[model samples]
Target chain A: MSKFIGLIRNEHMKTFRRLSTWIMFGIAAALLITIAAFTAYYAEDSSGDWRADTEQQMQDLQKQVENGDVEAAAVQQDLTTMQYQLDQDIAPVQSDSLASYMESVMYYCAPFLILFIAIIAGGLVSTEFGTGTIKLLLTKTPSRFSVLTSKYVSMFITTVIFFIFFIGFSFIVGGIFFGFNGFDAKSVIFDNGETVTNNLLASTMRDYGLNFVQTLIYATIAFALSTIFRNTALAIGFSIFISMFFPTISFILSRYDWSKYILFNNVDLTVYNPGNVPAVDGMTLGFSIVVMAIYFVIITVITWFSFMKRDVTA
Target chain B: MQKQPAVEIKQVTKVIRGRKIIDRVNFSIYPGEVFGFLGPNGAGKTTTIRMIVGLMGITDGDILIKGNSIKTSHGAAMKHIGAIVENPEMYKYLSGYLNLVHFARMSDGVDKERINEVIELVGLKNRINDKVKTYSLGMRQRLGIAQALLHRPDVLILDEPTNGLDPAGIREMRHYIRNLAEKEGLAVIVSSHLLSEMELMCDRIGVLQQGKMLGVQQVHEMSSEQTQMVSFQVEPLEQAAIVLRDMGSKKPEIKDKQIIIELTRDEIPAAAAKLAKEAISIYGIQAETKTLEDTFLELTGGKEIV
Candidate 1:
């Protein structure tokens, strides 16, 4: 156990000592602050009482529903959600585009975090192989399994640390621009055209939690490729390309009945969000989780086996 | 009483992609001695070193280090081995001290003082805190040695350890290698194409060729085989040539007014007396032995050692 811990520390030292890692974090923090700053500058403040505005908007949507609009059901669901928030005495968020921007960032912009995390995971093992440090590392007392596990453990620790930093910094900067209010607000979504409600903060937390799961999966793909190929550029390039473009490709393929079984289709756990309709029919959170779990296990097993058996000839 | 060998490589073979890279090779390295692995390019020297350190797998046979088999109990075997395969590749981004500290953490009982001691041993105390990237190749090589020595393993394997070192650095490395064997009682297996360095550094030298072990011989024993080269420079070369021919010398070549012949050490004085008796004034007569290079060339069938 002590040896494994030492290996982890060594792996962390090798990774964290690289200036590129710190610069990546710097870029992430800068991005969050810039987004917060942009929101503060361009987002308009509420001109009147938020409750009254929500009530009026609900009435207008009700009228549109009564007039037999083409999207009457969705409009009606929106009216019901607005009425629920109004009845709860929670003033609707008052910014033009900055309302709950933090939650939105956590929800939709997690790919940015995953992108950098993938880069890191890709470089972790690949850099060691590329730089020929694996030769030195493996000659030590630790088994190859232990060394590989330590590298993966270090990657996990780095991911969690960076995640917390990104979230914390986003909170501070996001709070400064938009006051830390509206957490008591309800998160309302239309599930299959039916209105569903949740605590705003709770649902946002769940989204961020699930988002990390996706990041783990994406980072695993990058890491597995890195270890298998021993090339950082090829691993990062292929994994990032898949992460960025797989969804579009999956969307096109989902027209086929079996597309839901594809890894790309199931990786985005967000589609299972309450009130969010999955792009493919009959897909559920439980199903996506199961599929991802299988892929995760298979990839992990292959990577571990290869690392353990490979010859450090180079 | 006989001590067990520090490293016993028993019939180890390696096959990559269905082609044999190392074929049933066997050798033993003993404590308190430096063993040199001499081979031409692509002769599986590094491959054998890799197997000894557990960096590469053994296909057919097992390598034992301090009585632990690398094939079955790698952790136990690896605990007694420290190696720098090929070039000393390190994390160039890290400072030399940190690199040692990082490697020191892998094994048991290596503390701050031990790390400092190794730093002093490798003579890197002056530059231990500098980033490895900023270090010269020789410095990196020393740092690599320090890291390998940190764990105080029983066996030290260095493949081409002096590859990038300057002549001064090479001499220093050679000194340290011999010093470690004597002072620390660590068995050192150094693989190099530099026959001269190996001759000066190794106690026993093993020649490998085409995935085969030619033989292992004590350094002096091999050099002693060629200690009978006699060359005579006579004032009258024609008379000396005739005298040497009459003495039944086998194809003595005359070059630069000297007749060179190969004879046993006991025959040198008699051959010189015979040449002088022939009325040929002997200007100079010198006896010299061939270097390890000649022996190596003879063993490897004149193939160059890369």
Candidate 2:
């Protein structure tokens, strides 16, 4: 067990010591700062009467519901949340508030997180083969299984580190752009036709957690492709292609009842959150969990087996 | 009493994509000996080395390192083996010390002291902290040796250890490899297509051609055991040939105004005395020793060794 940890530590050293990793971190931070600056630049004044703004948003949502401009259930949920905010005298968090900026930019950051993780995971195994270091790596005391598992575990650890960096950096940047006064802000959530009040931090954490799951699935795809193909470029390219296009493909295929089984359709567990809709008409959080679990297992098994049984001819 | 073989390859065969890359190859290397795998390109030397190091699968038979079968107990088997297959390709982005540390952590009980010791042994202490990309090829090769020796394995396998090195670097590597086998009592396996390099570095060499083991021979004995072609530049070449034929020399031929005949080391003096007694004036006598290159060419049917 200690040896395995040593392997993981070795992998971490290799990953973090590279200039490319720090470049990725720099790009992620730049992206967050840019988004925060843009949000601040364009943010409208929200210091007016909160009750008037809630009524205005509710009226707009009602008009959209009547005109069928959006799904009635989703708009109805939004309407209920706004009404609950008004009834509880809880003002809607300003768009420029620290918590609101973080939440708004969190979804935008998810794709970048997936992209970064995909790039990292894609090169994790294939780079060894490309550089011909796999010979030295696998010839050690640890088994091939242990080596690959350590690499994967270290990839996850990197993802977690990147996540914390993203959250932490965004918080600091968001606080700079917008005052850090929304830490105790309340958020009104509509779940199953019922309104519930939750703190901003809790809801933001929940959203970040779900987004992390999505990033993990994408990372797994990239990692599996890396093992199977032994080409870092192709693995990263295919992963990026999938992340970029799978949603549209899933949407086109969603008309078919079997489309829910597609990984992309089930990967976005955020759809189970209130005021959002699943790609398919009937995918519960439980069902998506099972589907994602199956995919996760299958991809992980294929990756491990492929890596273990491969001949390191490179 | 015989020492146990540090590494044993028993009829190992590798079939890739319906083609036999390595066919029933067998050899063994005991401790304190340098075993050289001499073969041409595409002769399955790297493939066989990869199999021994668990980089490639063995289609048939097995490899045993320190009495542990690589197929059945790879972890245990690998613990006793250190190998650099084809090239000493380290992570160029990491410093040389970190690269050694990376490999050191993969094995059991290899500490910072051992890492520093190997760095000193390889003479890389001056630039051990430099990134690998900044090191010269010779420095990288030395670092490669350093990483392989970190665990102190019984068997050290290096495929083309002198590849891409200057002459001085090659000589240094040869000395290092020989010292490892002799002083440290490690069974060293060095693979190269250069016959002269093998002759200088290896105690014994196994010639592999077309994925088959032709023969394994002691490096010193291979040249001396064979008959040599002795040429006599005589006043009368035909007369010398006839005198040599009368003396029962086999296939004495007169060519280029010289008589050439095959003679063993023991027969050379007798033939010389006979020629002197026959009144044949010998202007010059040149005895060409049979080199390992000649034997290798003969064994592989003159296939290109480079």
Candidate No. with top lDDT: 2
Q: Record all residue pairs in model 2 with backbone atoms less than 3 Å apart, i.e. clashing.
A: none
DockQ per model, Cα:
0.78, 0.80
Among all candidates shown, the one with the greatest TM-score: 1
Q: For model 2, what is the alpha-carbon lDDT of residue B306? A: 74
Cα lDDT for residue A112, model 2? 87
In the predicted model 1, the residue pairs found to clash are: A191-A275
In the order shown, the chain A TM-scores of the predictions are 0.90, 0.89
Poorly placed runs, candidate 2 (over 4 Å): A46-83, A189-196, B222-226, B230-263, B266-287
In the order shown, the candidates' Cα RMSDs to the true structure are 3.2, 3.8
Candidate 2: tens digits of C-alpha lDDT, residues B1-306: 199999999999999999999999998999999999988888899999989999899999999998999998999999999888877899998999999989988988899999999899999999999999999999999999999999999999999999999999999999999999989999999998778889899999999988999998787663434677888888777777777885434789888888888877677778888889989887888876455678788898987777
Worst 10 residues of 2 chain A by lDDT: A73-82
Q: Which stretches of candidate 1 lie over 4 Å from their true place?
A: A56-74, A96-99, B222-226, B232-254, B263-287
Tens-digit lDDT track of model 2 for A37-128: 88888988764898987798788888887888988877766777787888889988777889887887787888889998999999999998
lDDT, candidate 1, equals 0.83
Give TM-scores for every candidate, taking all chains together and pairing residue i with residue i: 0.91, 0.89
